[model samples]
Target: LKDALIGMDLVIIPAGVPHKHGLTKDDLFNINVGIVKTLCEAIAKCCPKAIVNVLSNPVNSTVLITAEVFKRVGTYDPKRLLGVTMLDVVRANMFVAEVLGVDLRYVDVPIIGGHVGITILPLLSQIKPPCSFTLKRSEYPSSTILTS
Candidate 1:
C-alpha cells in the first residue's frame, strides 16, 4: 500500500461493501468503518499530504471516522479530507429531470439532509430550472416525497 501511494497527490478510498438488502445500518457501518479505517491509516502513514476523498458506504459516518483516524496519527487536514456525496446529488438531479420531463443536463436539484430513508430531502424550492413541487405533483409515483 505504501509503495502504491507514494508521490500521490490525491487518494480516493472507496473500499467497502456495497449496501445490500436485509443488512442493518449498524451492520453496514461496522463492516465498512473497519475497511475505511485501515485504508485511512495507510494513507496517513504513506501519503499524508494527499487530498483524501472518503467514498465508502455510510460515508456520512465513515468520513467522520476518518478524521479521527488521521488526527490520531497526526495527519488530519480538514480542508484536504472530504466525504463524497456526488452519487446522491446525481441521483437527485436525474430523478428530478425524469419527473419534470426536462433534459437531464438542465436539472440541478441540490440534495440536503442525510442519504438514508426519512433523512433524504431534495430542496425543491431551490431547483435551478425553477421548477415547483407542490403537494398536487406529489401524487405522481416519480414525484413521491422522499421524506414525510
Candidate 2:
C-alpha cells in the first residue's frame, strides 16, 4: 500500500466498519482509531507532506487520534489534516431545506463539531439565503432555530 500511495497528493481515509453492522460512528473508537493510526503512519513514511483527509467513522474522534499520531511521529500539520464531514453537512442541509420548503440543491448548511447524533453540530447561522427553522409537530426538536 505504501508503494501505491507514494507520491499521492491527497489521501482520503474513510476506512472502517460501516453502519450495516449496527455500529454507530462513535462505536468505531476501538478499531477505527488503530486503523487510522496505521494508515497515517504509512502516509507519514511515504508522503509526509500530503494532505490527509479523514472520512472514517467516528470522524470527530478519529481526526483527533490522527492528529495525535502525526504529532507523535513529528509530522503533524494542522493545515494538512482534515476531517471531511460533507455528508453530515449535506444531510443537515437537506433536512433543513425540507423544513423550509426550499430546493435542496440551493441549500447550504455548515455541519460542524462531532458526527454522532447528539454531537453533530449543524450550524444554520451560517446558512446562505439565511433561513429560520420552525418546530415540527414531531417530538424531536431542531437543536436551534436560525432565521435571517
Candidate 3:
C-alpha cells in the first residue's frame, strides 16, 4: 500500500463493504471504519501531500475518521481531504428529471450536508431551470432519499 501510494498526487478511496438490502450505513461502521483508518494511515505516511477524496460508505463518519488519522500522523490538511457525495447529487438530478418530464441533462440539483439518510438534504429551491412537482406518498413509498 505504501509503495503504491508513493508520490501520488490524488487518492480517491472507495474502499469498504458495499451496502446491501436490509443493511444500514451504521451496520457498515465497524467493518468500514477499520478499512478507512488503515488506508488513511498508509496515505498519511506514503503521500501526505496528496489530495484524498473518500468515497467509502458512512462518509459522514469516515471523513472524520480520516481526518483523525491524518492528525495523529501530523499530516492533517483540511483543504486536502474531501468526502465524495456526488452520488446524492446524481440521484437528485435523475429523480427531478423523471418528475419534470425533462431531459436529465437539463436538470441540476445541488445536494448539501453529510452523505447519509436524512442528512443528505437536496436544496430543491436552488435547482437550476426551476420547476416543481407534487409527489404522492403512494407513488413513492420507499423512504430512501439517496442511494449509490
Q: Compared to the true structure, candidate 3 yields what TM-score?
A: 0.87
Model 1 Cα displacement at 71 (Å)? 0.9
Pairs that collide in candidate 3 are none
What clash count goes with each model?
0, 0, 0
- Candidate 2 structure quality by residue, lDDT tens digits, 73-107: 89999999999877777777766776777898898
Q: What TM-scores do the predictions have?
A: 0.88, 0.81, 0.87
lDDT tens digits by residue: candidate 1, 24-43: 87998999999999888889
Error of 2 at 65 (Å): 1.3
lDDT for each of the candidates?
0.83, 0.77, 0.84
- lDDT (10s digit) by residue, model 3, range 1-148: 9889999999999999988888775678888999999999999989999999998878888999999999998999999999987788888887777666689998899988977666778787888878664557314533354544
Candidate 1 whole-model C-alpha lDDT, 0 to 1:
0.83
Candidate 2 deviant stretches above 4 angstroms: 24-27, 136-148
Tell me which residue pairs clash in candidate 2. Answer: none
Worst 10 residues of 3 by lDDT: 137-146
Rank the candidate models, highest TM-score first: 1, 3, 2
Model 3 spans with C-alpha error above 4 angstroms: 22-24, 134-148
